[model samples]
Target: MLFKQRTEELNMKLNALAQSFIGFSFIAALTACSSSGFERTNLNQANQRYHAILLQQEPVTLNSSIPEGAVTGASFGLFTEIDGDSEDMISGMLAGALVGSVISAVTDGSNQATRYRFYNQKKGEFSVVSKQKFDKNVQCVEVHHTNKIKLYAVDSEFCRLTREDNSVKAIYGGKLQRIGTNAWHPATVIVKDELIIAVNPTSQEIPAGAQLIDGRGTWLIPGLVDGHVHLSQSGSAFTRPDMIGATHIHSYGDDQSWLIDQLPSLLEDYVSLGITTIADLGGPTKSLHVRNQLNCESHCPSIISAGELISATPVPALNGAQGPTFLNTETSAEAIAAVKMQRQFGAKISKFVFTSEAGLSPSQLDKLFSPAINEAKSLGQIIAVHAQDLDYAKAAIRAGADILVHGVMTAPVDDEFIELAKTLNVTYMPTLTAYEHYLDIFKRQLTFSEFERQFGDHYIIDSFAQLNENLSATDQMFQLFTRYVPFVDSSEKERSSLTPQEQSIVAQLETLFSERILQIQVANLFTVANAGVRLGFGTDAGNPATLHAYSVAEEINAWQHAGLDNLKILHALTEGNAIAYQIEKKQGSIAPGKSATFNLLTQDPLQNTNTLLAPALVIANGNIIDLQENK
Candidate 1:
């Protein structure tokens, strides 16, 4: 009887909602119909007037130049009636539609014609400007807004937009040098759109009325590529605290909204460091969205991503529910589905997790890797396995994984392991700096440079500083430690004043996996590089103590410390990484018919890798970025 009464009341509420929705729909439809008719007439009239004026005046050709100090404005306008114009009308139409939707509906809908109104200095009044407006005396410009966009009409090419360059640019009179080799020669690199058209460009004239940049005494090399990074992971100090097994103070995971908002600035930071491409090893679906977003922009590194992680059941590294980036699969079908999902999300690499502690067993590993590898191969995605221990490394290599994302930290790489890697043609991505970062965190020696302090996450820096001052604080780092290791203490004051037994345990812990582990890892890296096993460069920069932009150089220095050749390091940073990532045809080299992604250096990086520490200018996809302001 009670259920019947509740159902009746719910039905009545739903019926009321339905009636309201029907009335709203009717009003919307009627209003749209009335406004469309009025909008179409006005749009037609605007188009006719705009075209008639253009037809009367002989189209004047204007130079693309701006006065020293001029105020520029961009609103919305439609094209004139002249047909066959190839300018983009989408910007104008979208701007007009946005304005119309907000302000009024009486504006035109038929003719999407837009125009620019220029403030002519000599005339002392605003004059209508067309594609042919040739007045050089104009100091200011404004765009006129209308309802209809003249989709087929010619847009005014004479309007001077602020910070907008719509032509192929050139940098000649510079010594172009190929990376990893000591070959420097006088050559001109021609760029069209985002690709390099020619090297030692034989063209008699620049195409698209190119802008010239004087590269008189500079050396050019392919832009750097970091093989492993995580875009979604905040490499800031505060964010890394959660990784240390600490009490929750900082948020562990960022929502999609936060990821999207911070992506632009993060990409710029990578580009500012002369990085043109980076492979994201693992992250949530939000990472994929951010990757696609950056691929569309002019000033960002080309992002290749894993999209999601395939891990053992329980996901020892991170929880899927809390961190939505990893897919823990206990069955072969589940593993295949995870790989398929990653492929669907446009992942160029498939990342599998192999941890020694509570990770997949041998049989479970077989079930997971066999199907995951098959799916990844079918999708043409490179397989990267994160294996931190020797056993896991052997298992990944045996499973035909294309890349080992990290070196074996607990043990040295022996002859057998090197031979197996060589036989399988597997690339070794030695994240040497990552281990060093762990040591830095354990020792409380983490410090930031001025640049990091200026641009890094302030919350992270402050929190880490607090941790350094008071290791016993129940902060994010403390939470991380306690969550992972139950034996660890959560009490701030008690942890600070450790008992004698606890102090002894801590001392033993320090020796167990501290500096000695890093030394062994570096030794393994040296052995692999020397034995001719393919060595790839990666810093694991998104981890704690490893920063994104700055860590590229740090990784190089670590390689240098490991006694790797400078030329080999450069190759790994560029051409080698491109081959590993399968983007050699499009990027990784500054050859003709490649991407115009290279760094303009004041000194030759072949002489000293440190030369890349400060690049004069960084070019990516034909866009020359001035790093002086950012520096």
Candidate 2:
């Protein structure tokens, strides 16, 4: 186990060194051909948020022409002397014309391009590869098109540059609605590079050559964030063998291979679904490898990951899962060592598994979690625990757990717990859909919404829809998993096309509300919300049936049913989660000097929660995402 920890730390170092080299080479290449220019453009673009100017432009050479070459050659061949060897002159002209034709044949092209150096007020200077030539001594508008920036010439007499700036994007005429606020107003948001320079400017404050985005009748808000997810799983029926024992149909090793290969696309899928950021609660060491890949990607969601789950007990349930699962630490010394290893591997949070099946005993909870919690605190890392059971959660909180990664279930929230949570400043994320999705996966019924069918990886979901294909495996899973939530009955079985043994798992399976623990989970959510507990939204994506991106709307429905208003839900999904995780400085809200990672919706998110799934525009780290392209 220590060897695995050492290997992960080594991997992080090698990854960083390699990435630095890659970054340097990329900047070098851009220097020769793209934005890294030879000299400063240094126009009136400094000390302002959204104004810039073009530094210089180099036009690509025009194509050589045979007719023009012939004319030039004829002129050279013609003699000024009168009546002297007209035939000689004709012969000379023919010979020169033939040579010119050969020369023109050697060099010809039509794809003319221009390399323009642009200086922004805040982001400094960069070069652009454009098809059209941008004029000098004038302001330009920068637009992202087809994964590249496009420049348009904008001229205005009313605008003047107080500081040197060449380019700016004034997204004009949109009703902006910020998270946690019901207020809306028509405003022009001026953006330079990736940050908002000005939300609304006076008429005289309009910068020269600012590109305008038609935000008319649109709702622009902060991009959504999924507070809890696991990149190690594939969000399919076979992703977890410890939970379902589906190894008979699909081995865990092969399933993980598919997921690792598909992880990059999954990152883009998150942004395409209007989620620009994600917090990976627990995964294997290779989750760091995925984060490395994410760092190199152009269009993807930002990730904050805990490299592996530091278990308080030896986990038999995770035996066949992806990567090494030998992270169980029992002693206080072992617990502190595990925290150090995760921190060395670049994990921002120290996450521990504290469930009943494979968690420390109630009496041993403080002894095991305390040392790790203390080490994490000393190392400036957050402590998150997977303690859904009420008593287990209380134990972790008392042990200085900063985040309860799941809702406190198995009991209702009382004044004692709420007061404790408030006093500890504990953040809670109620991953409402993962339980139901798991039930559906094991019970042999998955209701794929039209949105899920359209946006989700259909191949993965379709694998579960093969009726009678793996009924025995499904039954095996159902038998093993139903002990925790066994509300399925024969009445629902009579309506299905499946055999009696299968329990009709595919005919609009109803919510298992009769389950007492589930009732407690729902009741505890609204109780915490009204009690003013720090609440965040997460779907426990990568768990069985809780597909990434496609699962947000479903969880939104659950939040609504739990009596959380749409505004609160939106805030929880965005700024609330960021604030909980202490990452509001980098993301979570749309504000001046912050990263321009937000979404434009076709409908009001407050009025209709489902509309969050479909955004008209999504910007992640300043790169505009095309939703249809992902589809």
| Top model number, lDDT | 2
Kindly give the number of clashing pairs for every candidate: 24, 14
Error of 2 at 470 (Å): 1.8
Q: Model 1: per-residue lDDT, tens digit, 416-513?
A: 89889999989999898877766566655567767567666554457566555555555554434333232232244545677677655655554444
Q: Which residues of candidate 1, in runs, are more than 4 Å off?
A: 1-168, 178-180, 201-210, 237-242, 253-260, 294-298, 313-323, 359-364, 449-451, 454-457, 469-512, 626-631
428, model 1: CA deviation in Å? 1.1
**lDDT, candidate 2, residue 97?**
75
lDDT of the candidates, in the order given: 0.65, 0.71
Off by over 4 Å in 2: 1-167, 201-204, 294-298, 316-322, 358-360, 466-468, 473-514
Q: Model 2 shows how many backbone clashes?
A: 14
Best by TM-score: 2
